[model samples]
Target chain A: MKGIYFLVILALVTAVDIIVPYFFIGGIASLAACYLFWSALTFAVIVFAIIYTSQWGRRS
Target chain B: MKPLYVWIAMLGWTAIALWIAAAARKKMRPGASEFFIGGRRLRGFVSGMTYAATTYSAFMLVGLVGLTYRLGVGALGFEMTYLIFTVLLLITFGPRFWIVGNWYGHITPPELLAHRYKNQWVAVIAAAISFFMLIPYASAQLMGMGFLVDGITGGSIPFMIGVFIMAGLSGFSALYAGMRSVAWTDAFQAVTMMATSIIALLFTLYHFFGSPAMFAAEAARKTPELLKFTWTPELFIGLSLPWAFFALTNPQVSQRMYIPDSVVSLRRMVIYFSLFGFLYTIISTLFGLEAAIVIPGLENPDKAMPHLLGKVPVMLGVIIFVGIFAAATSTLGSIILTLSSLFARDIAKHFYPEIPENTERWLGRIVILLLLGACIVFAWFQPGLITVISSMASGGLLVMAPAIIAAFFWRRATAAGALVSMGLGGVITAVMYLANIYPLGWWPSVWGGAITLLLFAGVSLVTTPPDDADRFISSVERELVARGFRRH
Candidate 1:
């Protein structure tokens, strides 16, 4: 795995995670909206991990 | 809420945990490796469950719930940020740790640093930092247990009794069979934590607000401030920064990257742990919101969950009580086991390189008892800031982050860089925490992390790099591709 790719992706995700919650969702006073956004963000990262590791140990 | 019910439930849980520990000990082989890391033969499920159990603590049901009750949706954001960072770090570093650990037979995280830096002092200092930082975090687990039992039983159980019971159970799991017993019991505890929390959550949703939708609607309507993201930027970053790097910094959980048997098992470990963490974070936060809506106006936010328990049916209250007990005990056991291995493998072996494996193991057992004694004393006073204390531990350990990352990715990184960075950075961060000095309203973690990074890079630029830095990095890189962890 190239370290830079993972680093950039993670940095971007973290930035978005911080900025979106504070800027976009902060004013929305609904639990469902904030809760859904966080759940989706976390779930997306997990899916990315799954896909990223799918190629491991597959070399012939 | 009766002490009798709590006692009976605890007894049944202890019986089951001991039975599992005994079974694990039977299968355990004879060696320091076996004692310290289950001989690195653990399968994916056990590895995943233990990771879940160890990474989480009563901090989830008790501490995090309280944080959410007080702070609102920002609490969920902070926790979810941690989960996101952990999964990313695991995917990036898990295989590297597994490959190096298996090749070098390294039992502790600091040992990995020693090999990379070609200096034993690197390992010793790293281990020392871990020992000093994790004590408060471990004691916070005990205090969580003590407070929960005391709160649920209406103080009939007494705080010290709860503390002693958890410390005793955790101490036994660590001393009995080391990692084998701890991992097995942790797997059991992880299941119990998830299952009980889920059941209680569902019951609360249905009983309190008629359904999940109703619960959400009522939460927004009744406590609109909680639903709104209200945390200040300083507060959010201060709390989330240390926890964000937890998978890479905390020795107790970071050391777990060495346990899975293969690449596939490592993958499974990350996936399982991710799912468990996501679900548990949501459940804990939902309970916090429910408590805010149903049982508002509590003087101490930490008592939110326990107060909510009082409002629930007796059976459900007891079930949630055991869940928090299991969470605290599992986390405490894992920390004790990891610290003992660090003491034995890094410190003891560094002093006496010719020490026999059995002697090292015995020394580890002795350290486990001493660490438990210290934690019990710490818990007895009850800091009452469970979440803050836990975060302080993580922040202190965050000093090691630059050293660890540079070990694999930056060949120019040197021994002086790691030592100066961790040593000085740890001291400054610790002093800041003790003195309650937050420079310019920022947490110590942010300042410590920034200072450590600067020290690591700047010092390495002036100092001599290890002669074998290239060989070490290339060999690991070659193996990564051979093991299919990386593409050519």
Candidate 2:
């Protein structure tokens, strides 16, 4: 993944992070939904990091 | 609940930390670089652990728990957002900082700014702003210790003693072997922090609600409003904006980007720190929800963790106490060590120019002593808003974000622009924080960030760019491609 691609992905995820919490999760008064959403979001970002950094130090 | 148990636990933990520091000292080499940045040869795991420990402080178990208890699911969102931004920033800036630091022999983040801007005053001013801003942040760490001891022991042990003990141990670790001792002890502390917090969290869940699923059900039913996202957009954005940029703006953690041994190790540092942050954030926030459900109506939200500890078994309570202590001490040690390096290298050595490497190291040691003294005094007062104070410090440091980003990406960024933006923006933000003035119900960080970006870009556009700016950017980009950090 290139830098621009990573930035684009992050921007989209961040928007989801903010919007989902306020708009969707706000109406659900259950801890399960909120916890699941954040955990899944954080896990996804970490996956992206792993993919992006796989070739960081390798010579092409 | 007993003062004796608290003292015994603390003493044992400090002894182990000192032994680790002693071992690290045996491996230490003599020089300014060795003292400040571990000769830039730190292994990946150590690099990652120290980064995690330094970045996530006592604030996690203490301040974050309280925020979660009072506010609700927004706390998790705020913290997770910080983690995501931090991981993204590290992946982006880590290689750049590592390569530039190695090529230029830069010992501190401000020194990198100085070299890129080609102006010593820029580094000096940045270091000064760091000193002015970070003291409160460090004090928040100490304040966490004080509150932990005071709350858990039921005020049997005075707050000042807790404050003094943490300050002394952290100072000793930093002064003994500089980055070597600090980083090694930090690895130990990081492990202790995670283990103890996880054990305590699980026990709390089981002891109170019988299972994780039950705990979630109980929390949702008992405090449904907290499960709902309730923070205002202004509050959420204001609090998170500075922290979102923390990896770039906070000099303590940013300086770690210079210490990895290789590109592979740098990669491990980012990945490990991310995983660690992810787990720790979830645990800390969960503990907050538990506190709200189990013990509600506490006047001071910051007391939630300590109060929860009081309800747990004695052994578990002491274990968690040591964990919070370890967390605070490691963070304080790292901050003190980084700030001292900034003072010695950017401020002291810049003006003197003739100070020997050994003398520079000694100067840093002296500054560590002075810095710890300042933090202890600040913590003595026992600040009320630990989370807010920590955020304000980052907000103040946010003024440098533009200059920092521009250094690697924009050739037109001028030294004068960096100076004007950082200096003016820092002062204005600090004043707003001091004067308690938030214009239009927004945060100083928000306004300060916008103004700083404008100042940096506007000034750089009109001023003469540095002659070496183009060469610096092109060479760094070429090196990035050579190292396979860039695909094309």
Candidate 3:
């Protein structure tokens, strides 16, 4: 599930890189894409943190 | 405008930074581990700020502005790639590093590599390459400081002296308090940089265009290419990929993972660092674009920031100068500390096993001073091709990224394979860059990284997996467990 989310986000970003310039979004598309990239990355970090922290707690 | 006030403000900031260093020193022990890694007690916010400040550096502010000014919006691709690369770094490697560093008492990348590969020679060679590559990088920051001071002061102070002052302060910070001082200073610098960037953007946008739409239209009118998001295939594949890889594998950056307090802090750092990197890039690029509209066709694109700030209110110019210095010094301090640690822990410890901890700490300090002196001498030579130096260093480090990734993930990876791939990757990229065989034009990073990754994957597939592969992987798993992260 995590890997799937990563792939979907990456695909969306790549699509933005490809399609946004064709239309007249006027650079906002690039900005939005950058934000989405950051969001996805942040989500991944949170997921890892939750997993790691929970595991640590269990072991103790 | 009173020049004296500007000098006073700069000096005042320097004194505050020094006081913080003094305070940190009093509380900390004087040993290599304590000095270099801050006794491994840094919290999420401090580590995150340090990572962002060091990663962004003066290059992003001055050099990146110039790049955007010349290359237009396509340069944002470099920034985007960096964001992606850093995210990949944290998710895949950060937790592992935090656990391994604490568990094995690893101080440097090569130290960990040495233990994993069971070869001290590998660690020595890796350290040598990393330390030498860092020289040009550190010198570039010094050169940037020199340029910033000269630009702001209008040549009252010699560029060399400016370089010396910034570099000397950075050296002192690293020597006095090590990573602890560097991390605290970075937090302060990061805040100042973000504030200055926001103020500069607000002022530039108001003075030029009242709205986002107006700003885009104006930029389009001045340079239509500025609005375009296209890059040639050569650039997309050749330049972008290498930079992305470098964002992960560069020893300076990878080492940051070693210093975070815990796995949870490491996780928080990833989010904060990505946001910080994204915001900094967008604002800096916008500043460059606005500068393009204000001052058309300046021979040096690097002058965009200074030129734009010069037109702003006098008070803002002083603030911007301070911010630029912050960007440069924060980066320089981290680089100096990393280089010193690499020398002391990786090189000296491997060769001379009997050195006392205090002696090693002194060796690290002396190494910092020597590096500073060497950079000063290098700065005096003043290479005409500053961008080339940056690109070459980036390329060299990109060659090592694949090996690093494989070392972590691929159980089949061997010491010989790692070394061969990196060496060949670096060599091929250098030859191609010098010969200019392709139309790629000034992008060794892509070529080097592609070749390196291919070689690494190929060699790992053909060779027998390391005997300790399962054990190492399990250890990492246990570390995650210890950190409260459960396996899927």
Candidate 4:
């Protein structure tokens, strides 16, 4: 169940990561804000990956 | 861009790499296992470095930078999607592969599939697909060197000489002590690659625009289109989907699961590779974005990196050249070494069961020489389609993903299922890519993967599985718990 739950979250995050940047805030005229939003999303994914996998090998 | 500087950088980089290979020969023990996989005893750091070096190639610095230059923020999304999916997939499958590999003493990725399927043909088929797909990919690395040197020196070094120089060094690095030398040199080159690129990036940022903030502002002001996210969903999925499964589909990286010394080492390999990949992706993509601002109006987007180097200080430019060379050479060396192991263990030994281990080891070395020769010919006569071929390499290899995942997870998977899916799906995918045939705006990888999943599942249901499937699954399950992983 935990494994399935983790995979679900991974799938959702991946969908959001790909979908949002290209559709929602990507075409805005404000370059700095748009770039920052995209950059922040990428950093969030990286941080989440680090945190998620850090506990992958730990005893549950 | 002088002949002298190009020669100095190329020669100096080769000498240092060869010296590292020679030094690694002293630490390696006698035997094929030691030669092929460092006796399966590599510590976390070395294992991690080799993984990082093997996975991230010259493609990142040259091809990826070009993509980002031509495309925009969408390039970052495509690349980052790969990283995110790879890290997630690694967390899920890394332990499974490690435990199974350690338990069975599997020497190659194909061997694991062969063992699980209890069929020699599975290994042979997988190796054949890898050899076919990766050679063009490897040739692209050499072509990268040729392009870099030729562009830097204005053709004074000659493209052939540049290709041969990198080929000779790459061949030596792999042939010296096999994986031991390759891993050690890769670690060295990996560090060299990152450090030099970081320095170059900072130099460009500070020297040109005064700071990263300034660089971004200038880029946004100058070429606002390059800062926008404009990649179509089809284009994004087309490029990213294959790489999303890269950690599983590409044997050069998948085989690393068998090299780490323990579960802890395996963990470190994943963590270190993730962080390294994270930082490197940022650097490479940022360099691409910066290149657009500083050196705009280039006719060929692929020449962006070379043009950027031409604009920087000569000393820094020379250092950057060596760094890009290190990137290509490390990639070529690792690919050659891994392919040699695949040929030796999976294809050759499977055909000749009575062949001695000593003969098998020699066979691997011999294959390295031949593979390098093939790659040189391919690179020298460099096809104009190198980029297309390289892009399609991972996409074609995606045909293997369904089969690979089914190995550990799907008990109903049969040898016949794996064979037909990989062989037929790989053929269809390659053909579709080459013919520029996209079905309804979908990439060949998307089509191939969909077809492969259907074939794998459909064929697996009707075909009889090997009798050992239950035992194989149960053993891995039991070992996962024993290795401190909870199933739930």
lDDT tens readout by residue for model 3, B1-488: 24565677679878988888887777686567788888888888888888888887777778778877877766666566556655755765777777788888888887777777666766776776666667887788888778767766677766887798899789888988888998888888898889988887887788778876688767766677665655665665455565566545567777888887776577667667876877788888887778778887989777677677668788888787778888888888998888888888888988898989898888989999998988888877866445556666677677777667666666778777677776677678667765765543636666667778888788777877668977887677666655554455
* Clashing residue pairs in candidate 3 (N, C-alpha, C atoms within 3 angstroms): A51-B485, A51-B486, A52-B484, A52-B485, A53-B484, A53-B485, A54-B484, A55-B484, A56-B484
Best by DockQ: 1
Clashing pairs in 1: A1-B486
Query: On residues B1-488, what C-alpha lDDT tens digit does candidate 4 reach at each position?
Result: 88898888888878888898999999988877888888888988888889989887778888778887888777777877888788777777888888888778787899989999989999999999999899999999998888888877777888888889889998999998989899998898889888999999999999999998788778878878877777778888999889889899999899888888877788788888887887888888888888888787777666778888889989999999988898888889989899999999999888898888778788988999999999999987877533455668899899899878878777899999999999999899888987889999999989998998888888889999999998897778776665665544
Q: Give the per-residue lDDT of model 2 (tens digit) for B79-119.
A: 99888888888988898999999998999999999999999
- List the candidates' TM-scores in order: 0.99, 0.99, 0.89, 0.96
lDDT of 3 at B214: 82
Residue B464 lDDT in candidate 2: 92
Winner of 3 and 4 under DockQ: 4
Off by over 4 Å in 4: A1-6, A29-46, A52-60, B385-387
Give lDDT tens digits, candidate 1, residues B1-488.
88999999988899899889989999988999999999999999999999999999999999999999998998999999999999989988898899999999999999999999999999999999999999999999988888888898889999899899999999998899999999999999999999999999999999999999998888878999998888888899999999999998999999999999888999899999999999999999999999999999887888899899999999999889989999999999999999999999999999999999999889999999999999999988888589999999999999999999889899999999999999999999999999988999999998998999999899999999999999998888888899998777
Interface root mean square deviation for model 4, in Å? 3.2
Which ranking of candidates, highest TM-score first?
1, 2, 4, 3
DockQ of every predicted complex: 0.79, 0.68, 0.23, 0.42
> Quality of candidate 2's docking, in CAPRI categories?
medium
